[model samples]
Target: MERLKLDYNILVIDDDKELCALIKQSVTKENISAEHCYSGADGLILLEKNDYHLIVLDVMMPGMDGFQTMKKIRKQSSIPILMLTSKNDSMSKVHGLRSGADDYLTKPFDMEELIARIISLIRRYTRFNFVDNHSQPLTYKGLTIDFDSRSVITQNGTFELPRKEFDLLLFCAKNQGRILTKQQIYEEVWGESYVYDDSNIMAIISRLRKKIEPDSGTPFYIQTVKGIGYRFNKEV
Candidate 1:
């Protein structure tokens, strides 16, 4: 049996207005609406004014760049996002995923392939994107974190956190119920062994607690072990 097709509104956020025009022209087909924004700021503004089923984002831009922009969008909507990048490096892909992009395609890609990915991502998330995906992360209470897309929803509201903070929080969440020493956390998130008297770990933890905890002083998710380190309360 043939599946019923649905119309999709796709917003492409890239600095190259010319490329945007080319994409709009190339991807023109029935049931697909493609709109372009010149910058991340413009994209955010347009999002407030309109609705979209998905987003095609470019990695490098004048101001916000793809990572930063993706974070902001994830804060509000779980709409599938496909990131475009000129750099084909593994690090770039990792960073994009860690920053909240659903999927990524290197630049100079075939328009046809791009279109297909869009359809696939939309269909999967729109219908079959379930909570049991195990890959998904959530706060026992109110927080929700989508690791694949690198987004967070807290009591305050949805926020796209900076890269370091995201890593810190993800590490904490993954290690819930286990006490992670400052040295352990520093190495895990920042990729370096801990040094004495350094406040880098404390700083990141403090900032993260403020964002996810209902009350930083009396944190519910991340608990202070006092003189040892911190741990995400598994009991929460």
Candidate 2:
């Protein structure tokens, strides 16, 4: 059986009118629908009103600028963001990444590289079912976790989890109620057949718990098994 490719809506936020048109044209060639916003304030408004699969943001803009705009958007949504910066703006690029931009490219960028980044971000951040045997969508409490999107959301907020945190959460939830030993979690999450003497396992567990547990200091969902590993103790 053949599967249909998922349709995605992308928001391009840049003040450069000609460059915006070029980006739209290039993305359309790959069958992605795009919307353009020429101001940072307008971009924020549009984001609040509609859900976009991805956002292509220019680092330099009027009124709010990309960094500030990104920070504002992140406070409200977990949409994928790809930043556009100048070739000499490495420091700002790092700041963008840390501030939650999914990926980035330098201005005077190669069209092919831009296209590739657009495809990559969407693939890692949109809601869709995969045909090649991937993890299914999961819900815990009021939170919905999407493997395809690599994101987690609840009534209170949405967060962009690191890859390891997402994978660990999925693993624990999959085997809910079972006490998985440290060895088991390490091997499963790290994909290593051998064990190493590192506190990495505990660190990852603590990180995951902080996000999903309402009170990580007194966790109920993820309970430690005393000398073992942990368990997802949801009553289902």
Candidate 3:
């Protein structure tokens, strides 16, 4: 018998009650169930008590804020987190993504865009388990991706990566030796090419390299093809 597929449960942690309600209404369609927590502190409590597939977090909460909340969450789970902030500055995005957020969106964002990002993360985390004809895991050098278990074995360690990061690295690994432009990467990984934001891709790549490469600065697995795109080092 096949397991019945259920909608993904999402947690939204923000101080904006009205916006939370709006997001809950907007994303609570077909295969998504949205829940709200008015503050990061409250959200953490809910996190401990329940399971959620994705978290939509606000960066400017009253007390703990998104970064602090994310830090605590990372200590416990690798659930996909999409950070929302009013700040468009690069540093905020860097800090959020580096600390554990799977993606970031600025405030006053298009609801459609938010829904797209939320769905992308949920699908990657919950629905993906692709294998070739022989059901062999993908590997290069010491890195092995077990799609069945959603785990990766790297030179550093065998780790269960957050869904978005895993999918990003998997794509690069599979298409080794080919130049993948930002457009292609976004379209393939995000399922959209409209929002050409380099910060998000760069953040995920940075996080991936840290896990797999000996040194992120001198990456041996994925190389940036200056001015054009990235190439997964085929020689590896």
Candidate 4:
């Protein structure tokens, strides 16, 4: 496949020097600049000095594991993160996502898939960050979403959600009163096909509800439409 020419920079954090070098080489072929660090500490230092459009983080390391590194990074930056893990278990993937990773790839992944995911992440990130100067914030009830700032305000408090969650909420808000299928939500928000089961979407929706819903158990903003999908309550 011909790779799209992207001017984005990506950071790769892993303990394996060979693997990092390989990943850097693969992404560079697509005109996407990449820098890598063998340890989480070095990655953190590099992140402090440079701006990165996305990150490919490995879950296991000597110290300050990817989860720890990612948690610290999340405190300061909302850059898209795609976690790489040797473990193929669902729990590990879930942990990565909950720890602020935007996506995850199992070990021995195809180079094409990695490049595709990298491109998709950067594209979505660029789209979400691009806002019109004259655009108005979306306001419903006590919830307010500032598109330019990517901030969310609710009766509970103000929140700056992680990129995926914020994008999901923004998509739902834009199409309020419409029931969105899992496939639609996945392809749109994830910028990928809907091959996996609905677990990913459900996880994100659960997290979003906890943030914006008055009661997460009985969500007021996002309502599930039985077996079809979910609908953002227009009456909220």
Off by over 4 Å in 4: 132-168, 171-236
Ranking by lDDT: 4, 3, 1, 2
Between prediction 1 and prediction 2, the one with superior TM-score is 2
Best by lDDT: 4
List lDDT for all candidates, in order.
0.76, 0.75, 0.80, 0.82
**Model 3 clash pairs?**
none
**Per-prediction TM-score, please?**
0.54, 0.57, 0.59, 0.61
Q: Which runs of model 1 end up more than 4 angstroms from their true locations? A: 1-4, 129-236
Q: Which ten residues in a row have the lowest lDDT in candidate 3?
A: 126-135
What order do you get sorting by TM-score, best first?
Answer: 4, 3, 2, 1
Tens-digit lDDT string for candidate 3 (37-100): 9888999999988899899999999989999999999888868889999999987876776576
What's the TM for model 2? 0.57
Candidate 3: which stretches are off by over 4 Å? 1-5, 128-236
